[model samples]
Target: MEIVRGRSVLKRTAVGRLQYYEKEEPSVVRRQVEDTERELSRYERALEQAEKELEALYERALGEAGADSAAVFMGHRMLLKDEEYRNSVTRAITGERVNAAFAVETVGDELCRLFLEMEDEYLRARAADIRDVSDRLLRILEEEEKGGGRCGRGPALSEPVILAARDLAPSETVLLDKKKILGFVTEQGSANSHTAILARTMEIPALVSVPVAREWDGRLAAIDGEEGILYVDPDPETLERLKEKKARQEEAARLLLEIRDLPDVTRDGTRVELYANIGGPEDVEAVLGSRGAGVGLFRSEFLYLEKETYPTEDELFSAYRQTAERMGGREVVIRTLDIGADKTADYFGIEKEANPAMGFRALRICLKRPEIFHTQLRAIYRASAYGKVSVMFPMVASLWEVEEAKAMALQVREELEREGIPMGHVDLGIMIETPAAAILSGELAEKVDFFSIGTNDLTQYTLAADRQNDRLDDFYDPRHPAVLRLIAYVAENAQKAGIRAGICGELAADPSLTEVFLKMGIRELSVSPSFLLPLRKRIREICLEETENDQGV
Candidate 1:
């Protein structure tokens, strides 16, 4: 048995047949074609067919997978409609008189190379998505060339297997069968990468940067995601040890299931509202399955991010309405478009900043661009008619910003009332992410229905560290005294104002900090669906009074 160490993204064991996702880099060549019109037609038809295929995939993914997962196909559909991408292929086909298939490969290759050359890691990693979408178009063209028209559905595994890959894009991961795929092991990706985040969200055992995974194709392997170890061609002892570890993990999961439907209560009987933070309508399914109390942070930004341009009020309303109705009267806190910075859409025309994390983003942009902000508010207010829906503003720093956001919502309410549209009770809340918000939580609390502390941003802003920067890992501790103090301060002030105070960030899912939060009397915790059971178990195991007395924590 050979052991390889890698960075683990979750704590679990996966034992199964290994299947590697290795793509053969094609050798693109400009080939002369006899008829240019036919070749151009082939390219056009290929894009059309690719779009149709992606639409089918999106629908299937929506029904089977969740909305965030289904969004990958929508993204693919967008790429298929890229004007520049289509124009580039057309230029190559007409100008060089090359085969249409060859022109597609040529343009796709150039785009992939260009994205890879980008300095930003987010942009560089997006190279995988570009390649994935391009591959779909080429596959269609190639299949049609071979006299195979409209080959059925997507790729799937025959049986359960350990999915090994050179790298996994968020889009490609969506196409994978979650039930058939045991876990992920990649030759590339760091512990803090997007791949890692997906793995954690899925509760899948994953180890990244495992170079030896390149050679583990079609072999039985054992993965220890907690320890970041992979045993290839395991000896009897290694296999037996892995089997036992898997058994223990399964037992732990079963134990967690026992408390699945139970309320999140501490040993001292302090009941907390355990909820979910979701991005789309499909995520409501996961929330229901997990028995989450409600939707704490419905990231309305995702709808805007996925759109080609600004999502119309009707489209936004439909999505939010579906999500609210599905929740069946559960609390649905819809945060307005928190766009700009790293989470940007091209149509928004937000200029790149030297320090985007700290610059004009979230509520700052929404408040400045009131039209876009009002459009989202109108949709959200309309959706609230279906169920319990509250509105929250992100990146709130000062009292004036709070007053301004409330004023906009008031205008939306007045407009909707004048139009005689059915409206629901929409409670206003603010996301305490900036240090300025936390420090003055008491003043801010008096004006809102609730406060959801976005600890991911709060920790970074409090410590003056970038959440995305790996170099700041040492300095970006959420459990740091300063960060906890701020959270406690918010909770305390929120209590005084008779408002619900919750945490909807990575920290809410952290078992290590559960006791601390409980002691602070933080009433709500909304994490990803996978974290629901585990976090509930943690909450039940803690005593708020005991934890409060324990200074060593």
Candidate 2:
């Protein structure tokens, strides 16, 4: 048996026939004009059809999977209507005088080439999304050409198989026939990409970036998605081993559902709030499914990043309100526009930084652009009226910054009340992600209602190492004594100040460190929705008294 390896996007086990799906790239030629008007009309119709399909997919994925998983379709829908994309395609068809299908193919390939040429893999994967959407447009045009006929066109599953592809786009995955599919293996994709999130919602194991998967067509394959192991044409012994492994995994998943209903209390009877860190309103579904008590961190920056224009107050308010109301009164802490550092938007006019990760971003951008800051604050405050809502400022360092942010929020609250807008339960908090914030936790905690330690940033700031830099990973340990010491310091200070102290970072999701966090007097853990159940299980098993005397170091 040949063993092929890949990166695990969503961990699960699957054994089935290997189905190779070779995607055909669109090819078009530059031709002379014959009928520009017909070409433009055809292009418009196809674009409209693509938008309708994307919206339907979004509704379906949102209902079944969760908002986080479905969020990628929203971007696709936005791209369909993007002025730059539309204008480019229109010019290609009208000016260049090509068929609508060819025009779309031309524009899409050009844009995808630029994205693929980028140094960042995240940006490069975006090319696949464009390619996916372009194919949708091409199909619409083809059907139009064929007397408006439409057939069942998607991933054609012949059997319950481990589907192999170059990559699975969000729309493509949603449109797939789920009953006939056992799992998925892709030659290229990002684990953190929305496609991975979609795979999790489908409750199937996915192995991605398997360069050899493209060759395993028609072979019997056994996969351990949990460990990213792929057995190509396994021997009988390997097959039996996988059968046992699959049974254990299925049993483990069934047990995890029970953990959701179980209390997130330690054996010693100390209750900890098991919360989920979300990106947008759609994630509330996963949070509820995982039985999260509250939302510890809602990264509001996504609302800003996904658009060419700034999101309006109403747009931001609706999203926040939806999440708050959906949680059914559970606390939803909305972190205000944390859009600086590595996340700069062209519309925001944020200057390029020599060191973006440590530069003008998040709170720095918000504080500078008072108009942008005030708009989001008002929306968040307004959303509070629906259910339990709290505001969290990211990258906060100084007590004065907290006071300034708090003052602006209060000012916005009064402005809303003056305008006859009703507001509800509002709690303001600060994130202790910098060394300065950790060191000044006692003073900072005194002013805020709570403290959420963002370990991803705290570790980087404290250790002076870039967390995203692969070469420096050894230097960027979240379990480093210094990082733990800072966390311990914050926990102690929050206790002294009688404020709620929680962790909403990658550290909070690590089960091995669950006991360590509880020992530090940290009672709230905000993790990814998928981690809620596992972390809860770990929490219930640990006795805080056992690690009571051990220093974090």
Candidate 3:
């Protein structure tokens, strides 16, 4: 067996025949054009067409991969409409008197090269986005010249196989039929690329930077994404070994499934609520499949991030209502518009910040822009009539922020009531993501109905480290004593105030600390839907009293 190694984005395994995906590279030959105006017009038309294509892809991705991954297309759309990029393309077309396709290719290549040379990996990963946009425009220009038809090679295989590629753009990754693709292997890509993000969202086995040969296209392959290894043309002995491993994995999955309908309880009968965190209504299926007790953290910013404009109250209501109805009476806690930081939209026109993670983001933006907050509150309140719904404010630090948000929510409810809009009782809550909030959780708990500890941000903010910066990976620790003490303190304050306290972050899904959290009187744990059953399995095996002796709780 020949072993290929790379960086793994998703920890899953798949065994299938290899299928080398041959993407059509656009040919942009430089040709002199006498009519500069016509060339410029052609470029504009191609840009518009590219934007439309990306919009449609965004919609498709929203349905297929949910909003978080789908947001890549919105970014693509923004890049297509970027004034600087457009100006560069136009300058080459008009001044150099070159073909629209050739100008686009030249400018796009230069931009990609510049981005790739950036110091930050996140910025460097954006080079793929530039290439994606450029290739899209080129294809549109080519298609228009040929009089209209779909471009690019569609899925070549009728059956699912290990998709091998040089690299995949977000557009190409989203366009492919996910069911017909078993997994992904790329010779050139970063772990943070959009293609990698989509793979994680799809929860499929994916390895990047693996040197793959076209000759192995039809060979039997087994990929272990957790190990970042791909076995090509595995020997009989190796195949048998992989099959046995696969069987064991499947058996473990089956065990998790068996407990899907079971309660979140320990061996000693102590119980806790287990819920799922979701981005949008599309994730309801996963929640239901995992039999989640409820949605503890419904990130509301995704609704705005995926749109070209601010979503209307009706639009917001429709999404929230759909999710709530699907959950079928289970509580759906929708966190109001946690925008900024890594999540942003062009329409918002938020200024570039030196450190956005700690700056004008989340509840700060909402409190400053009551019009936006009011619209969301109205929609959420209206949706509450359909099912069990709760509204939470994110990035809350002090009493004033919570008080102001609550006042605005109250005003919206009163407005809706006066307008004869039907609504239901919606619980008001706040996310204790900041250290200030956690330290003051007792007072904050008395003000809100619940407290959902956003451990992801809490950890970063407490540690004073940017979680997204890989350079600080060793320095940033969520399980640090300080973070744990803060979490336990929040739970204690929540218990004293007679309010529910839960965790809704990366730490919540960690099975190792499940017992500690239980011992701390944490009322709930919210994680991605995929982790629900396995977390339940972990919880069922734990005894809180036994954990106290081991962890000094």
Candidate 4:
């Protein structure tokens, strides 16, 4: 038996025969071409064919998987259609007088390298996407050159197997017959890769960075996803143990589903609102599947980061409207343009700062650029006509910042009304992520309808530690009394002002602190959709009266 360890992407177990996945790499050789025009024409034709294939893949993914997984193909399509990429390919073919295939290979390699060199994790992950799209184009050109019809290709599976690969692109992962695939172990990939995201969304066991080999193909294997271990040609005892573990995992999942439709309340009859945090409209399906009451944090920066340019009001409205309509009248608190700092778009042209974490980010960018903030407000308000919608401002440290953001929202509403545009009631809120905001929550509570404590930043800012810095793990404590006191203060201030205060950060998902939050008067928790049921189970088991009695209340 051979044992290997890797990073786990999901906590599940699988026992099956190991199968190695091999993809044919299309060969491209640089050759001189007499007709540059013809080469460009061939490139355009291949691009068209590749685009159609991606569109078909998107449809398949949308039907088989949920919108969140399907959105990767849409992103691939956008990268395919990007003007700079098209122009780069054109320049290579026409300027070098090279064959279309060679031009694509060279240009694609250069772009992939550039993306990989980027410091941002999001941009770096795009490197795999670039390679995926490039490979697609090459395959199309190869098929056409060989005068053969496109190969009807799929991994031939006679039975369920643990698929092992060097790495998997989003397209490759999505195209696999999921039912025949028991789990995945890749020699290379990160948790942020599209393959990992798809695996997580599918609720499948996945291990990345495993030292897999072709020799293990067809061998009986057991995957312990919780421990990120792969046992190849496992002993009979180990196989039996893994099977038992798999059964227990399945049973646990079934139990969680039993409480999916139940109210998120405690034994003492204290009701807590459980919502989901989403980055885009595509995630709404996951929220609904997990039975989230509403969207606590609709991160609006995705619209900006995904596009090469600023999104139009109409474009923003379409996304928001889609999310609201799908939520079926559930409240969607849209946080306006929380970009800069860790998340940034080149189009914004934000200059580098010594301290970006606390520097010009979030609402600071919005206040400086009122036009951008105004456009987002218009879209949110317009979408409110379809369902319950609210707007929140992030990184709000001072009262004037909240007042300025509110002023812009009011201006957008008035302008829409003047233009005869229909709208609905849109409540305004601010995030209590800054220590200054928490300290002055009593006064700030009067200006906003609700408060959502962003504990990720609150803990970082309060303790003077960078949340992203791994070395600060020992110092950056979310449960620190100082951080909890701020959260309690914000919740108390909200209660006095007759407004709801919720937590929409990583801490909200920590089941260990569930009772602590409940005792702090925080009755609402917004977390990743996958955490909904487990947290609901924890809340149901808690009796707040017992804590009160222990405290001599």
Per-prediction TM-score, please? 0.87, 0.84, 0.86, 0.82
Candidate 3's C-alpha runs over 4 A off are: 1-5, 17-24, 110-125, 146-155, 158-160, 176-180, 187-193, 209-220, 232-236, 417-422, 462-485, 545-553
Better of 1 and 3 by TM-score: 1
Any residue pairs clashing in model 3, and if so which?
Answer: none
lDDT of each: 0.82, 0.82, 0.86, 0.86
| Pick by lDDT: 1 or 3, better one | 3
Q: Write the per-residue lDDT of candidate 4 for residues 1-553, one digit (tens) a residue.
A: 8899988878889999989988788989989999999989999998888888887887676555554456677677777887778899999998999998888889899999987776654455567778888888888888889996553245667789999898877777777788898998998876546678688767779998898899889888988998989999899888899999999999988999999989999999999999998878887988999889999999888777667689999999999999999999999999998887657676787885656787889999999988898889999999999999999999999999999888888889999999999999999999999999999999999999999999989998999977654345568789999999889889889999999999999789889999999998999999878788889999999999999999999
Please give the range of 10 consecutive residues that has the lowest summed lDDT in model 2: 466-475
Query: Over the stretch 15-100, how does candidate 3's per-residue lDDT look in tens digits?
Result: 89999987877777889999999999999899878878888888877776776678778778877877779999999998999999
Question: Which model, 2 or 3, shows the larger lDDT?
Answer: 3
Q: Best by TM-score, which number? A: 1
lDDT of 2 by residue, 124-205 (tens): 5567778778888887887777777542145778778888898777776776778888888887665645677678767778
Off by over 4 Å in 2: 116-128, 147-154, 213-215, 278-290, 299-328, 338-361, 383-386, 397-400, 416-425, 433-443, 455-489, 547-553
CA lDDT of 182 in candidate 3?
79
TM-score of candidate 3 to 2 decimals: 0.86
Model 1, span 411-516: residue lDDT tens: 9999999999998999999999989999999999889999999998999888987666555556778888999999999999988888889999889999988877
Give candidate 4 regions above 4 Å deviation.
55-75, 115-126, 148-156, 278-290, 299-329, 338-365, 395-399, 417-422, 432-446, 453-498, 506-513, 528-530, 546-553
Listed per candidate, the RMSD to the true structure in angstroms reads 3.4, 4.0, 3.4, 4.3
**Cα lDDT, model 2, residue 543:** 71
Each model's number of backbone clashes? 0, 4, 0, 0
As a TM-score, model 2 comes out at 0.84
State the weakest 10-residue window (summed lDDT) of model 3: 149-158
